[model samples]
Target: MTTLPPDETSQAATPAIDEPLERLARFAFDWADTLCDPDHGCGPYHRAWSMIRLLTKNSALPAGGAFIADGLHRAASGGRCRVLLAGAADTGLVALVLNALRAQEIEPEIVLADRCATTIEQNRLFARHLGMRFELHRCDISALTCRPVDAVVMHSFLNFLPVPARQAMIDALSRALRPGGLLIAHQRLDVGRRKHDPQPIKENRALLESAARARGYPDPLARAIGAAGADFWSNTFAHAPTPEAEFLVLLANAGFNLISLSRPLAAATNSPLFIAGQSRETPQAAILAERMPPR
Candidate 1:
């Protein structure tokens, strides 16, 4: 566990590091593009928008507005916070959160890290347009060293990871934050009615195949299913849904004292997962030590 030195000065430009993790991150971005395109039926960007709308309809604010408001409140309470916008696939949620922070008069030094080069570039362009400065890192969350941050956010990105990977990522994030720092995450967590059933990889493939057919893709549904199956086994299948208990345990292990968990007003039953916690203590060293023995 080598720790990177923290950026001390407010508004200082933090330099980006080019490492193996960064390269892998670039690869992930490229891979993600295939699935995220609007043409693709399962584009996470579109899915996230749908989820957001379902969550915050009651409030005058938009779907992700509550999350932004929560973060802003936390930053206001803590003062001059260093925030990490982890897995900022697209800039939609990040923009909302940043806007909320700005509204509260909190000068947040934001670090935007993600695996997608296109998204990173887009975010960079967007930030420039807004006259804002952010440190961009192209690296996987697991590969990142646990530097102290006042808060961390993962908007609609955690569900993409497998169960073990999600836990590992969360643990890493917990380590990255300073004591009492906030961890804001939004994802769909219900195993659906098929909780015991394995992720309907085959079913999802069928859906993709049907989508391809409807779109009149050159490839037949069988071929598309086969290709998607290959991709799933090779890449996406490793990630699993984090059970609610597991998620809570991971937070506790990471040293986060649960502050709040909100259910979406529009579709609380359908949307089983929501914002989890704002940690109040450093994660218990012993629990982490037991789970991850020193290499």
Candidate 2:
């Protein structure tokens, strides 16, 4: 792998964010740093406690990293490629990517994107630990300015944006990619009717039960967690689910050709992986006309 000076600066000016979002992002950054930081002792995810690990999706990082590495290999530019890794704050996913790239003998110029300042700092530390270099873009995805790159890795991150903004972000990302470049995105589908519309109380209850079992918790603790399903869902993801079709249409409108979309795991699957290509062919007009209007 080749070496270069790491740049931790954002090219764009700081975008305005609401105070609530700002606080939430900070809290999320602190939570991640506390649980995943190598300098910190007994990081919960590091310890593999089932509740936190499952809640945070730490177990999926290895597979996600391999999927990204495969795409990078196909791009095939050795150490000279430029790649963007977006939305990687929760786990050691960056470290996994760095190791995979090293094994392939490729040291691409990397740009790491996140809204959280501490998350950006954590990424810098991981790069130092891995001896890799990256430029940090410290702004929300919706506010990002596009730059051409060979590949982009987005993992279960864009869902937080409102629908229109999500589409705009995808369009920007597509424009940012070099022709024939790859984009790997993992998103949780909000499709089909369920027992709960926005509040996944049933699922949360199951998760609590499983978590309790994993931690060898007594029945009382399990009952308490199970009872807090509404609060958990509200605090975690308060937005209404995005219809899966909306997501596909957004990609189509952004001029990407969907290459593969993994089957969503049982309702348990939070995000299913999608690999797409910036079309070498002309982008067909978005398929909006072909689908029924959203309910």
Candidate 3:
């Protein structure tokens, strides 16, 4: 019934960016990351992440509304829907995903599965604001143990997994779905990037600091946040990239039948709702798959 928080979206963009929502989501994620990440986060790291994410997320940020809503319609034959969100960095994505369900006028029974308590809690608050029916459980995707649901939705979530963990994560997602259940996702592709590879660190602290400063953050705050974000980003790039073919293979291996794998094209569906935040850094494809009946 709502799109992403209006502030995180651009009215000009397909899914208007909601600035205030983005700010709150960034801070929540940074706080969670500092607490849960291997880097052992501190106050500085949290602040840095909040600033860094807001500036840098432009490339990989857009999670559209229409594609998701369409997928739900296709997967569900006119009834209340049950959805599982595998993992998300912030509530921004959650709001965008839920907005799709809202637009369809479906009151979804939603479950959020994540390892971060703060991230889960933030979404809980947002869901409550809308009076949605939802539940939160703290768990890792690779070892997901939730009841089978009608659909599992993810946004740019594949590459976040470390290469070794990708297989387990995919399998877990499959397991989380019921027979004929759907998996709807949009993921970025890095051509020819292989398993076990790590994405090279592209931006340094100086660059992030410069970006933050340009966004009107003060000198000390900008530099500190930039440094923290730089280090945090470096530590989290274990999944270098996923080639298109490789990603398809993972889906197939998980017992999913491809429904559609598309780009945001003029004549194709969901184009109006897709706000492409993916630049050269994170070109994306929309994927909808179904868990087929067992042989």
Candidate 4:
């Protein structure tokens, strides 16, 4: 993918976020550097440091920002909107949800869950900024259980898990929501994908380098993270995405009914590779689903 000019894109829509985005990018760069001191063994998603840089460099606002806004507006019935964020690497989604809820005059009861402490702390930055109350959890979201909420939100998270775990996560999140609760997310999908698929850094180096240069981050040390990521990319795409049909089946088996699913403009998926003539160009789609109440 050729680099889209940030100024020519949607970055201008979110003003004054450059400062926080820089701080987060710098922190992620330092952490990624630590993961590479001896080797890439620590895993890029260990603290989701890789994602912070990639997100800051490749995309301005979260791709699911519009879905989050519309979902909340659709679900809010002049009452508090209870939400559960299944996983997050930054404050963008949470901030978007909060801002959208506020616009609807709906008080939000939000619970944000993730396994990485760094990301949990990273998400806290926005909580502090928005001055919104948030209940945070550091754990595998697939194993998470709680009182049913009104909706569950995520952004490109299902691809991080193998297909079985991905389904388990859907089931778990389904149980966490009240009957007829919403499941909203942006996910990459294609056919015949597997976790053991080979993903060479060579394929992504050009894309990474282009993004790194386009972002032109102010911090010099952090600026090198794109190169570092290209070199130490063992953890990049360590998992596989679900097939589109299988994903729909999983949601259905988990008692969810599809509300809407569509690919948004300028949004891309991570599974862009070719192995043995089989293409892995998984595309991203914005999904809004509702869990069916037991009869």
- Estimate the overall C-alpha local distance difference test score of candidate 2: 0.49
- Each model's Cα RMSD: 13.2, 13.9, 7.2, 6.6
Give the least accurate 10-residue stretch of model 2, judged by summed lDDT: 280-289
Query: Compared with the true structure, what per-residue lDDT tens digits does model 1 show for residues 124-204?
Result: 655676677778877678777745777777655666675667767777787777666677765435442122123444444
For lDDT, candidate 1 versus 2, the one ahead is: 2
- TM-score of each predicted structure versus truth: 0.55, 0.56, 0.70, 0.71
Candidate 4 lDDT by residue in tens digits, 1-295 = 1222121222323633332665665555556335322332434543334343344333245555556777877766557888999887566566667766776788888798877665666666656665656788877888886777888887778876766777888898899888877988766666333432334444455455555566664445334554455444444554665777888998998999998877655433222222123333444577889989976
- 1 or 3: which has the higher TM-score? 3
The residue-by-residue lDDT of candidate 3 on 48-83, one tens digit each, is 433444565442334445677778777664667788
The deviation in Å at residue 171 for candidate 1 is 1.1
Off by over 4 Å in 1: 1-62, 77-79, 192-239, 267-295
* Clash pairs (backbone) in predicted model 2: none
User: Each model's C-alpha lDDT?
Assistant: 0.48, 0.49, 0.62, 0.62
How does residue 135 of candidate 4 score in lDDT? 85
Q: In terms of TM-score, which candidate is stronger, 1 or 2?
A: 2
Deviation from native of the Cα of residue 154 in model 1, angstroms: 1.8
Displacement of residue 100 (Cα, Å) in model 2 is 3.1
How many Å off is the CA of 202 in candidate 4? 9.2
Residue 285 lDDT, candidate 1, scale 0-100: 8
Query: After aligning candidate 4 to the native by TM-score, how far in Å is the CA of 222 from where it should be?
Result: 4.6
